[model samples]
Structure formats: structure tokens, C-alpha cells
Target: MLSRPSGGAVMKYGFPSLSNIRTRESYVSSYDPRTRTPAWVIERLGGDTLGGNADRKRCDFKEDDRSDACVRECAGVSVCVCVCARVRAACTQVSACVRPCSVHVFHRATNGDYRGSGLDRGHMAAAANHKWSQKAMDDTFYLTNVAPQNPHMNQNAWNNLEKLCRSLTKLYANVYVCTGPLYLPRQEADGKLYVHYQVLGTNHIAVPTHFFKVLVLERDGRQGGVELRSYVLPNEPVDEKIPLERFLVPIETIERASGLLFLPNIVRTSGGAVTAAANK
Candidate 1:
């Protein structure tokens, strides 16, 4: 388990897992070592938190290797080894450097892995939502906060969805977004349900078959009223013409699919009734 951060505002409603939790400048994430991706990422958004000169163009996706050594090591390893250099006087110079390096290794997805994979490094906690600071925007680029997403969907539908989240700040006082990946089981021709997804690169980062985002929208204030809207989108290309509301699903559906609970009771305790979007 990683140490919790100073501010608890980002995780106002609580998260799914207690293990492997990491705190960032703009968001909180639970790292999944096995998948080399975030299990879930939660962030709070509002008009104030969205205004800044942070440039996404200046940010680059990097391995989050500064946290717990175990988590960093699990991402990959860099080991210093002996190097032999030929000398001009019939003698060779040998240098032996025995040090631990964790720049890039297996069991973690590097930027190179997505180079030809036809998949985009989709952000779970969108960078645009964290324009409050450059560090915040930079943290969202961490590989742990990303997942493999279809290029078409990532650039089209998914990008639109992210824009919608940012746009919601105008209407709502506070918007808490929880996003993650889901690997749903599908029934094959043999009539057996199986969970199957592709693995990318030498690290074999598991590609999620579906992705989910749950929005906790505060009407007036934190104690005002709350409305929940949950969505699930397939990993493949989705028609950009389709309405986002078409993918709206009950919060319970997401809970069952991702094994993560969004505490509705806590939202209700904010002195307002908690309502979820009607199931479609």
C-alpha cells in the first residue's frame, strides 16, 4: 500500500481499493501491477480547477517510478552491468557499475509499446481537467494512469466524452469523475463466457475490452444535491454520431462490471438526495 496524500478532496467519495493507491497533484489512482495500468482514477473538477496555462503539448507519457520501490520495480528494471572498452595500447578498459535502474523494463508498458500497436495511450484522469497546474497535467501522463484504447474511439468518442466532463464544470458546482477499464466476459460460439483481451508489448499490458466513467455531479454545493451518471463504452471504434447518453448505464452495472463501489450512501449524507441516471 502507498501512503495517502495530504488532501482528501479528490477522493471525497472514497475509492475502490486500499492497496496500491497513489496520489497525484490533480487525481488519485489505484495501480494494477498485473495489468500495468490504473485500476481506477478519481479526480475532482470545477471551474477553478480547470483554469490554468498548463500545456498538454509540453507533457509526455512517462513511467511513474518515483513511488514505492516495489511498484516502481514491478513496472520494469534497469540494471547496471560491466562494459568493456578497447584501448589503444593493447589493453582493454573495463568498467563495472552495479546499480539498480528502473527506467524501463518488462511488466510495465513503455511509450514504445504503443508505437505500432494501433492503440492510443488513453488517459483515465484526463489532462484537460487538471489545468490548474503544469505538474497536475504532467502527472496525468504517467503510464499508470493510462490504458490502451482504440485510436478511432480515443480520438473521437472518448475525446468528446472527456470534453463533456470539462464542460460539466459550467453547470455543476463540483464534478467528481471516476474512470477505469473493464474486461467483460463474452459468450463465444461454444456458449461459454470468457474474459479475453489482447496483451501489448513485452510487458504484455492487458488491453481492456471496455472502459467506464462515473460522474458524481454536485448541484449546488458539496451538501447541495447529487446526480450520478455512469457510462460504459466498448474498446473498439464507436460511431461518433451516436449520442453519449446512449451509453448511459446504471451505477450498479458499473459496480458489478468493475468490482468497484461508488459509495452512494456517502453522497446522500451530504444533506441532499442522491439520484442516479435512469438505466437505459
Candidate 2:
């Protein structure tokens, strides 16, 4: 069994197990040694979503040198999830050294993947949220934890949402955050909405049309009931003036779209709620 953090009741966070996933296509879960918990799980998909070449790639390194290199199964990263908590110390500045995964090749994003691609190497597990330790924050930089994200969306609205998660720590004992990419539908000239998104790099990394953040707050200490909040933001540039509540959607919406289940052990009565104060 995994050891729980000291000084608090054991609270569950991060991606649930594969048994909990209803849709099993292109999904894998792994435990992160640094965080001592489930690092992140992803639902890999092809470039067109019609199922073409979305499979993982094998490591090209030799046997003797293979230990330090990314393995064959790390290529097709679609979405990633990680539990986030606020740290007591001020957030540190770490150089953005985006590297490929040594264990799972398709599971991680490469530094060259985002080069000249216009999209930012957006972190599914925002580094600032894990300032509790250098390793915790460093683990978040792994390519598997990132997806191609619009710079406007990542820097502005998405950044705001990250801040909101950090702020909740002041009110709750810990904040459980699950972030991932979404491929949503859009209406076209024919008035029909179709699910479409771009793929980046030779590995065909899927660029999500939108992103989601699901926050579970452990209020009144870990013993108290939890509060849930889920938000879905477009991958495009969002107006900075728009309130974060505008992106709020029922958790059911995310479950249906992402094929991932959350907060199954906890009792949830209604959709999660978010206040404007959280934006500040």
C-alpha cells in the first residue's frame, strides 16, 4: 500500500485506476516514483480520430544505452492528470527544459514537437501548483504531462484557472486537480458540429480543441465533505474579461467527453460549484 502524506487524513487524488475507466481504448495508468502516487494517465488517439497510426513508438536507443531513453510505448499522449496541492513556500522558477519520456515514448511530448508549432507546451499538471517540493514541481515538466495548447489560452484564462486551484488551498486542506485536453465539436457552414483538432509533431500528437480542470476541495480538513468544481475551456484564445464561471460545466459533461471517472469514492450530490472569489 502507498503511504499517505504526514499530518493529514489520507485523501485520494489524481487519476483513478484503469478498472474505474469505462472506455478502455488507448488508455494507460502508471505510478510516479517522485510523487509517490499515480503520476498521470492518458487516452491516446489517432490524428484524425478515425483510428490511424495512434500507436506507441519503440525506443531507437541500443540495449546498453536504453535504460536512460524513452521506451516504445510513450508516443500517443492525448490527455494527462495529476493531483495538485498548494505549497507553503513561494513558487520557484524552474527552466522550461521539456524532454521526452524515457519510459514511455508516445506517453510524453518532445521539445521539438512544439518548436515553431505556435502552440505552447501547456502543462496538464501546472508546475506552479506543485511547489511543495522541487522534485514534485520537476516531475510536472515531463512531456507526458503536456499537450499542444494555444498560447493565448494557456497564458491567460488557463493560467487564471491554475491560480484559482492554488488559492483554494487557503480555504481547504488540499485541492485535488485533474487537468486534461478535450476534442470538442464545432459548428461549420452546414450548421453541423464536428469534432476536429490538429496534430503536432511526427509522432502525431493530438492537439485538443479544449482543456478541462476538475477540482475537488477537502474542506474543513480531510474529514469534512468535499466540494467539486469542473471547468472546460476552449483551446483558443479566451477573452480575459470573461468570468471563470462562464466556463463552468457539469461534471457529467467531462465524464461523457473524456471517458474518465472522478470522485467515485466520495459522495457528490450535485454539480460542483465555483464562486467569483475563486478567480481572484
Candidate 3:
């Protein structure tokens, strides 16, 4: 059972569970808005790591605080990662408009960034996952959390994957998710695939060729072990009819491509027992 800090009530299966260790990354921001130096970063709040701690640090959102969700803004890349816990009871349908984060100028994205680009304002941290509160839901509308994604892929395959994440709340005590962009390699006429991607606007906002989602699920009971799932999807239009199972990939694959680690402590606790399902 997972216990809520606010209510102090034990729930059989909770939406956001505690993590054994912090999962935020430390990097150098090359942008000029804030001090361009090395710093620790946390994208949003409401995940397994709620408050600021020694290991996990939070970013300053300057003026665009929504008071509902947390944000980790990468001014250098002009993209932000959003984190939140999905509670079925607090989930509400709310219509919100997309806007810019008024914080450190280049730290976030803007509407003009995607103006003529043949791409959708892809969300790194999905909006629907935060249906628990209208403010949390609206917090997702910030341009900083979006990337230039192929319209078809964003609306179809990616949407299905988000739905699957939400469904896991019913089976696990807590579900912690980390979503981000990937600039991967692609094959050309010569058959040699090269790593390359595009950027948009004056800020040079990166348009990832692929996106990744890493999910950590804690079982409902004391003996329930941790499970890790990772996926990488192309930024192109995918056939909606394709089964989502086709995208299941090994966590190592993501770690290798993104240069980030997920659930490092839990991975050691399970003795590396978390195996990737064979992509069928």
C-alpha cells in the first residue's frame, strides 16, 4: 500500500508512488537568460518526487506558474519536461489554451516556433495524464513542454501510448513516468543511417526525430516488485492501426540513446530483474 503525505491514508493502489531514489538529471544550460552554468534539474512536481530535496532539484518557472504542476525548463534546448501523478478521482475534463512561459526568456517555447512547420506541438509530458486538476491540466499547455512532432504520429500511436500509461494506475500502487525527446539516427539512400534532426525559431528549439517514455510501476502489495517499461517512437506519421506492443523496447536502449538513467536504485534492488518484453 502507498500512503499519501497530505491525507496520511493508505491506499491499495495509488496513482503516484514514492521512488526509492531521485530521478532528476544535472546538466549545463547554454542559454543566456539564466546563468549559463552547470546545475541540477527537475521538470515538474506531483510525481514520486514531490518536494525539493538534496538530490532532486526544481527549476524556477519565473512568472508562468500555474500553481498546479511543476516544470523543468531546459533553456538551452528550449523544451521542458512536465511530471505529475494521475489520480482517477481528481481527473477532470477541462479545456485550456496553449501559452508561453514568461520565465527566463529562452527557457521555454512559443507559438511562433511551430507556425509554418509541418509538425504538431507534441507534448513531452502529456496533458490528459494530469486530469486530476484543471490547473494541472492547464499547466501542460505551456509551450515549453511541447516539441515539433509529426501530426499523424502524435494523434494516433502516441495518443494510444498515453492512454496505456493512464490505465496502469489501476494495477499499480504508483506510476512514475518520465517523458522526453530524442534526436536519433535515420537511414538515407546509401543505407547508412545517420544521427540528425532539425531546430525551429530563433531560439533553435530542437525538433526531436523520436520521443521516449519511461514508466516505473510499483506493485500494490509489500512483496510487489518494481517494473520498468520503456518505449521509443518515431516522429513521423504512424499508422493508427498498428498495435502499440510493436513499440515496446528495452530500457537500456533508451538509456543509451538519451544518456539518462531511470530508476537506477530500483534496478539495483531487483538485481536487474526487470526485463524488456520481446517486441512482438
Using TM-score as the measure, the top candidate is: 1
Candidate 1 least-lDDT 10 residues: 80-89
Give the per-residue lDDT of model 1 (tens digit) for 18-76: 54666667787777778988899988888767888889999999875534655555444
**For model 2, what is the alpha-carbon lDDT of residue 56?**
21
| Candidate 2 residue pairs that clash | 58-72, 70-102, 74-104, 74-105, 74-106, 74-107, 75-105, 75-106, 75-107, 76-106
- Which parts of model 3 are misplaced by more than 4 Å? 1-103, 189-193, 268-280
Best-to-worst order by TM-score is: 1, 2, 3
TM-score of each: 0.79, 0.65, 0.61
The TM-score measured for candidate 2 stands at 0.65
Q: How many clashing pairs per prediction, in order? A: 1, 10, 6
Each model's C-alpha lDDT?
Answer: 0.76, 0.54, 0.51
What TM-score number comes out for model 3? 0.61
Which candidate model has the greater lDDT, 1 or 3?
1
Tens digit of lDDT per residue, candidate 2, span 1-280?
Answer: 2122321122243244432111111222343322212233432111112112222232111111114233333334222221122321233532221122333343334566567899887776665544343433454555556677899999999999987876776676656666776677889999998998787765566778888877777665335666778899999999999999999898889887876776566655666563212111
For residues 1-280, could you state the per-residue lDDT of candidate 3 as single tens digits? 2212221111211212231111112100111122111111112223332322222112222223333333333222322111222332243542222213223454445576667988887666565554444444444444545567898999999999987877777777666566767677879999998988777766566777788776766665664566777778998888878787778787778767766655534523332226322111
Tell me how candidate 3 scores on lDDT: 0.51
Which ten contiguous residues of candidate 2 have the minimum total lDDT?
A: 57-66
Off by over 4 Å in 2: 1-108, 221-223, 274-280
